[model samples]
Target: MDGHRCPGEDVTVSVLATVARFLARSAYEIPEKDLRIPLERITTAPPSGFVVSGFAVPPADRSAEDQHPA
Candidate 1:
């Protein structure tokens, strides 16, 4: 290891990009609620974990390979 770069960094970035793309195209609604994170907690997070509803996956976003499996 010549530098601090991780061997799986490229794979990690690719996976994250794929996930972001999927989420961007997907349709969903997050209910209105107090999403404030309390500073007192060590692991900061919303009091009630993020809640999503009315999710609808668009057929047009699916790739041809996904629509027809080998």
Candidate 2:
């Protein structure tokens, strides 16, 4: 019952674990200097929440306070 086969069972924990494993693998492959997860990120609502599986970020919503602040 490995991570690859866990998705077939449709178990929530297993699915989450598989996702974590995939993220871990990605972290391992990518250089640390290139990785960035903002410490200020908040997932309570839109614009800052996670995106997945071809869900596009709408063009009008801006997460930060300013787009081109000086």
Which candidate's lDDT is highest?
1
Best by TM-score: 1
lDDT to native, each model: 0.87, 0.48
Instruction: Report the C-alpha lDDT of model 2 over 4-48, residue by residue, as the tens digit.
Output: 664466688788997675555442222224234555766334444
Given candidate 1, what's the lDDT at residue 1?
A: 50
Clashing pairs in 2: none
Q: Model 2: runs farther than 4 Å from truth?
A: 1-10, 27-47, 50-70
lDDT of 1 by residue, 1-70 (tens): 5869988999999999988887888899999999999999889999999998988776775565598888
Clashing pairs in 1: none
TM-score of 1: 0.73
Per-residue error for 41 in candidate 1, Å, reads 2.0
